[model samples]
Target: MNTHKKQGFWHRFFFSLDHKDIGFQYMLTIFVMVAIGGFFAYVFRMHLAFPDMKVPLFGLVTNKDYNMLITNHGLIMMMWLALGMLLAVAGNFLIPIMIGTDDMAFPKLNKISYWFFLISVILMIASFFMPKGGLGGGWTLYPPLSTGDFGYNTPYKGFADRFFTANTFVLLAIVFEFTSLLMGGINFFVTTLNKRAKGMSLFKMPVVVWMINIASVLFMFSVGPLVAGTFMLLLDINVGTGFYDAYRGGDPLLWEHLFWFFGHPEVYVILLPPLGILAEIISNNSRKPLFGYKFIIKMTLLAGILSMMVWAHHQFVAGINPKAATVFSILTIIISLPFAGIILAYIATLWYGKIRFTLPMKWALGAITLFTLLGGFTGLHLGASVFDIYAHDTSFVVAHFHYTLFPTVIFGTYAAMYFWFNKFTGRHLNKTLGNIHFWLTFIFFNGFAFPLFLLGLAGQHRRIADYRQFEFLMQDPLPLYRHIATISAVILILTQFIFIFNFFWSLKKGKRVESNNPWDSNTLEWQTSSPPPHGNFETYPVVHHGPYEYNMPGKDKDFTPQNEA
Candidate 1:
């Protein structure tokens, strides 16, 4: 592989793995994925808000198509938008930089991982254009519904038995993507363990690196079961296996167990990095050391340990035995204790500090508040066996994930984008436009998802296209709730323009930056030029202090870089 600089668009931008190039590509791919996923969200929301209302803009769609939309939307948002973008993009960009590595252990392999990811994305996009349409099963691709024949008798149908072919492609693509993620994880973990410049110790590494390292460990181990399960499903579809076939004495429940075991871990995998980024942004902008930094790291470890044990909580209502449910429920609540500690630590850091309400800080703070409340409260409902009976699989369930995911993961990605844009481009983003983007998202996000909690509480089942047909909900239908949600959805879609505008506008015309440590960060990445040249540090950076040595009594400035005095 050539280590020398190149000057072409595809060579430099599309097919490069100089961590910076890979990071930007991951961001761009996921951004496009988010847009596609958001469009699906809009369509699904429209159907839910007005169960029988014909969508004026999407007249080609029908009720069966709507159900398919719901399934595809969930899959795209979870895997494509959240995981693909957050971990792949943000992880690629920040990991080496945070740990003070010049580049990944193997840059060419990094490039290979990204190219495979791009291929995976292309395959997923091709699913939508499949002859029978696309894979219609929810992201989980639960059997019976997912594997059954495609016809009117089924709840949702858009194409032919093309689900088998389309979903097969989706699965293959996902396998490649996960392979890339695993490779990246291995690189990150090894780099952190072996390559921290000259004197940076593990304990001295930033909390962001710690969080990401933990997440990478979780991904390495947790993803295996899902890969096994997906292969089983693929075989059951194509090669004629009885792994999940009940009539042949094969248990479908086994697949569920395998899927959720990996599935739930997948959520944490998507979440922790954003929180890591949030910690970095908040600590830097607020000009204070992260409170209870060690405690937060311990909590992340706890979250990972508990993540594997609570997969059955997702199966509580599926007849997994009351005693087992109770056990899982107790463990589920226990997991939240660590998260509570992390939240408290963040809030404590902000107490009486010199707070800067920049765009990155605004979203970081917003995510901390939103995720803390939602991850804690709804978690209680799911953790207690009694409430689980009522809230499981309802709109409340949907709202709970949306609250945790949209804020922590999605917003964190955007925050990192703003915080690092200048470093990547050597230019500052327009703060005014960024602020507009933040406030609008803050309002519309809650406006759109919060009401689903109420609707779920009122007994609306999830994944159905026509709610009016359900006689139980007729007496007290949630028309007003639906209206507000749909309106906000449309508005939210439009608000993303502020982001698109700010990003491109800043890249081309914003103020040029010369500061190496733009955020005055103590981490090693900040020791280099904005958009650090080819090899990250001109020479090597030797760490001399801990990550957050801020506001010492006799320091020249309030803080000093880890490599500095």
Candidate 2:
């Protein structure tokens, strides 16, 4: 029962089997990948901003280089940074403590997952150094365009000197990352189901735990087809198989169907955790119990189920039968209902309560507002098959998704970081710096994204290296909009340094928290020490109330801990 050990660096870090250690490792890895992905974004934004000007570190980004940057940026942020941080980092770190367990059901598997993920990151970074540059087929990796002849071939001399093409490296990196996540998903499912403390019934768990479980199930089920499809793509590229090659009777649309089948649900997989995080933050800061807890759970379930059926909506303009498109459009819109309920439930949680405008709360509230507006945009425009026909592959679609994802993944993660930093690092972040980071981020994020909507409305297509090439985009106002957005993006990227400094600086020099429950919250995580020890609880906690028990009329304290006897 004594889980603590005298450990060396590698034992504690690289090979640690403890869930907390693995979770920390996952977070660190996510930070590194996010920087790399952000660099790619900066490079591409520069290309878009000044088409003729050579970039500093990376000189003139060719069309191929631009494509690779876009592809990798999307893939890394979505797969490695967002998914890894939310599920691998948050899920591993929080689930065991919240569920009153010492560790994940399979600790060794958790370590292995992180290692596989690290390997994936290595391969992805190595791809950039390849003579031909990295993959250029975009993150979707659609066929024909993604095939070996079209995607892997490089004009550079000695491209064949490498054992694997850059495109192959990209696919391999994905395969490794997917494999890592699949293992993590299994761990989440098994641990959450079997490891709860006594009196912790299914309904007694926090909404975040439930959301993680649901997202895990969705990921496990949806990713199989894409895994299979990726392997087929590798074969078509390297081994000369024609699974997606049209001239050999294979169909390119088959890849789209398979990819989006996983891709659409994948968005929800990244989304649900943030929603769950927001739920925790919003309720705790508002001094209220989560409104419509059961309702939110049921709606989240429905949303996950409906997510599978709506994949075809992404293919509306890809020449599917008109009736099929109609069916998909309707299903896509219908999926919005559960999300609407969840959003409303959050709003209800904040209704007329003693709302604390803490840094975390501000982020949670911002995420809700941003997600609602973006979600509304999707419902109003993109959900309609007819409107999607015109909006397909435009900057509008890009802006819409960034709105959903940036708020959910990035803002939600920030909220969790602020809310939980004391628990994780045993120190409070510099509040003034935190507020500065949040406000600047909020202003610049909107400044950067809102103009993409305008450009898309002006018929500006996505993935083009030079917008000036198109006569429509070259028109006075459209070009000017891009310039404004580019400036906003640069400022937005620069503002992140404030957050980075605050995070690391606080780890050593910030104010030390005097109590474990610094937020005065009710979750089981607060029952243990700040940065809880190796066997999380000295005595395993026994749950009494549900996670969100706040403002109980009879209780003297405003919040009620689940483990209170």
Candidate topping lDDT = 2
User: What does each candidate score in C-alpha RMSD?
Assistant: 3.0, 2.2
Using TM-score as the measure, the top candidate is 2
Per-residue lDDT tens digits for candidate 1, residues 401-451, read 889888977788888888888887889989888888888898998898888
Tens digits of per-residue lDDT for model 2, 1-565: 5566677877888887888889988888888999999888988987887897798778989888898899889989988988898888889988898899999999888888999999999998988887766777888888777664443333333334433677778888899999999899899989999999999999999999999999999999999999999999877776666787677788899999999999999989999999999999999999999999999999999999999999998898889999999999889888888998999999999998889999999999999898888745565579889999998878999889889999999999999999999997789999999999999899989988899998888998887887676787787898788888888888898899899999889988989999999888888889888878887888888999988888989999999999999
Candidate 2 lDDT: 0.88
Query: What stretches of model 2 exceed 4 Å from their correct place?
Result: 1-6, 150-163
lDDT of 1 at 10: 79
The superposed Cα distance between candidate 1 and the true structure at residue 62, in angstroms, equals 2.3
What TM-score do all the candidates reach, one by one? 0.95, 0.97
